[model samples]
Target: MKTRSKIEEEYWEALERLKSGTTKSVDTKSTRFKFTKDAVGREAGRGKGYVRYERYPLLCEAIADAEEARKKNGPATPTANAKLEQQKALKQKAIGDYNQLKQEYDLLMTEYLNVVRRNFELETGLAETKDVKIIRIPNVR
Candidate 1:
């Protein structure tokens, strides 16, 4: 049986080789094991034909850890930058749309208030004054 540390080390080496394009896709646990075995060579308890099904979970964990590390430490590729720019543009468009809607709301609200005040004056038999301010008190239920 191989030690955990040894297995992890081999996994990392294989991952690095894959990243560097020295190896192809390690898309499956079996392929990952094969890559690790090929890089670190076969051990006594884990011979060439060994299925190593018990180590599948550990290999998956290693792959996840490696992916996270790559995201944190790897260079900002053009694809990543393009995605960021796309998100920024979407956010800016949303902000602009919100501002436009807010302006339209304000305009509509002013027109509605004007109409309500005119109707109030007509109903109350009050003179049409330009400076009359309406104080709306909320009814607490």
Candidate 2:
């Protein structure tokens, strides 16, 4: 029933001992968790050391605990929730833009048909140019 903090503190202490070369040879993880012989920093040995699961069991456990908590608490942090909200807003805006474009297209198509019908009626002598009616919409933009 140890808390996450307790497990983490012990892990760090053990890691420090291993890195300092003070940990006993009998310890099962002494070799596995030993600090890499390759030096760090620019041109010291090779590349920067990265954390590996086998060498950092406690860290992995802490990460696993966080993931489990996230499952129960919805998202892990406010930043993640904020990102989700941002995605939702973007999707809504796209849908709104699409709907607006669709309405404009419908309006333009209707206007074109009205003009064509009016012109046909006048040319066929079915009605005078003044007698034919074409729709007028104001302030489209």
Candidate 3:
């Protein structure tokens, strides 16, 4: 097994402790000091939020990594997964429709060739009405 670095270990630990609770905190700040607030705010619009970069820098680094992973992977909600599934289904349907059209086009091409061959035979006087084999235009199955 690969060993976890101090920052990575702290990140995992924090993630375990926070779970879904980490989203409740905002990252706002004043120019001088550092603090944080609940997502809704008891401090109203003045959300005193910003951790000192020097203090618990490893944990901060870990949190940054977590946030970066979330940004890279995007939303993991049921709605997002459903959208992916829906897109796959649409692509499959489009491919099926294309294959169906290709088969139909091939059948029509075959009928056209049969008609052209009959016309050619008649024009060359190789086949008269009595000698001609009646080839009906085929219906698509």
Candidate 4:
């Protein structure tokens, strides 16, 4: 088992390596940190020849912190900007299509209402006129 102080020191070292881009991944075989079992027993003053399972969680936490810091400090690249512009254009096109469909729907609805009104007048025997006039109907049984 590694001492608490030694584990903390290794954590910091791993974090520094992550920030410096010396290692691309943490808590994996690809990790270049000397705290792993792979680094143990290889060379003197390198590291203990065993995996420190207890320190794994701390190492993972440090890696996550470094990644977050990098994200905040990183600038938006050109590719990211281009993707954003593309998304905006697609949204505009969809809005335009929806508006066109709405206009067509409104026109069709108006025409349908006019047809229904004309049919109702014909069935009721009502004539459109400026003045009212009485019409006599023949009684048929």
Cα lDDT tens digits for candidate 1, 39-127? 32232123443324365556655546656765676665468889899899999999999999999999999999999999987756534
Stretches off by above 4 angstroms in model 2 are 1-78, 126-141
Tens-place lDDT digits, model 2, residues 1-141: 545554345555544454344553324232232133211111121233433466556554554564455357453345888989989999999999999999999999999999999888766674445677655579887
- Residue 124, candidate 2: C-alpha displacement in angstroms: 1.2
Q: Report lDDT per candidate.
A: 0.58, 0.53, 0.53, 0.58
Poorest stretch of ten by lDDT in candidate 4: 36-45
Segments in model 3 whose C-alpha atoms lie over 4 Å from true places = 1-78, 126-141
For model 1 the local lDDT of residue 35 reads 35
Consecutive 10-residue window with the lowest summed lDDT within model 1: 37-46
TM-score (all chains, Cα) for each model: 0.35, 0.34, 0.35, 0.34
lDDT of 4 by residue, 42-121 (tens): 22124543334465665555545655665577654458889899899999999999999999999999999999998888
On a 0 to 1 TM-score scale, where does candidate 3 land against the true structure? Answer: 0.35
